[model samples]
Target: MRVLVVEDELPLAKLIRQGLIADGLLCDVAIKGEDALWMADATPYDVVCLDVNLPGIDGFETCRRLRASGVATPILMLTARDAVEDRISGLDTGADDYLVKPFDFGELLARLRALTRRPAAAGGTEIVVGDLVLDPVTHRVTRGGTAIELSVKEVQILEVFMRRRGEVLSRLQILEGAWDNGYENRSNVVDVYIRLLREKIDRPFGVTTLKTVRGAGYRLDEA
Candidate 1:
């Protein structure tokens, strides 16, 4: 998943970006609310982490403008203010969830996962392709009723494929889904991961669900 983090505190923004990257999610940082507005308009992010106190336009105004512009990307407002009025204001401005400053990192991740699992449009918590099943909430994957172990990056890549089953995805597309802009990987890095995914999700089961489309990209299909 990709996230846009709008935080003026340079250190805190960097730390948040690092934490999200460590969890295998792509992150882009915008220190100002105006910049965040444009970034949100340009990029298709799964979530936005907006700081309440931003330069020029505060997060509440930003959220209102975002909603006015019909951007439905989930927004998680972060603030140091713990007042009931502040929370109400954030939500009233169209924020989906709110987290106060000095919050637990694990809780933040859980909330982001929840937003992705249960979006505004109706959907289930799990994604299934053929006999392969993946649970976003549990972070678990099983193939033909057998468990499949995957690293954080592997799971992120697999989730991207599972979400777009039967569609071709280029290396750049997969990179955008699995890694942040800060990653400076070689072009062949995606190839390596695709090979690893095949070894775990296909070879052992005598399945060929993942296919290479010769100069196009890769595709995941129902077996």
Candidate 2:
């Protein structure tokens, strides 16, 4: 998933970005609240990680503005203060979840996943398309009772397709869903990864679930 991280602490911001990237998430970092507002307005992000102690317009104000502008993206506030008043203020200002400082990365990831699934509560934690089953929480995939090992990026791309199964997704759409703005628009990386994904998920089972639409894009459906 794509995420926007707003943290004034340069080192912490870079560290969060790196961790998110390693976990197969596309992440953009903004050191200032104003910059974050601009970036969030321009890009579609699955979630926002806003630090409470920002230079100007702090996390609470940033979140309030985001909601005021009708940006429905989930916001997870990060704070060093664990005070009840601080937590209540954050929630009152439109934050979806809260995390204290020096938190476990695993817990942070879990919370992000939970927030993203809020809108699609009907889908639950696991996704199943035909014989293929994916546990987003566990990062596990299996088809027809056989386990499948996939790279982090591959799994992320697959999740996008699974979430919107039967819909045609252009290269740009896939890139936006699976990659950050850092990727070149003209790059053929999507095609390369799609090919690799097919080798693992389709070819082994003799199924053509992921179809290429000439002059359009790609679609994923039941095999």
* TM-scores of the models, in the order given: 0.91, 0.85
Task: In angstroms, give how far residue 222 of model 1 lies from its true place.
Answer: 0.8
Lowest summed lDDT over 10 consecutive residues: which window, candidate 2?
Answer: 178-187
Per-residue lDDT of candidate 2, residues 87-137 (tens digit): 999999999999999999999999998899888788577899999998766
- Which 10 consecutive positions of candidate 1 have the poorest summed lDDT? 116-125
Model 1, 34-148: lDDT tens per residue?
A: 9999989988899999999999999999999999998999999999999999999999999999999999999999988877766733766779999999975566999989999
Candidate 2 wrong stretches, greater than 4 Å: 41-44, 104-106, 117-123, 184-186
lDDT of each: 0.91, 0.91
TM-score of 2: 0.85
Task: Estimate candidate 2's alpha-carbon lDDT, on a 0 to 1 scale.
Answer: 0.91
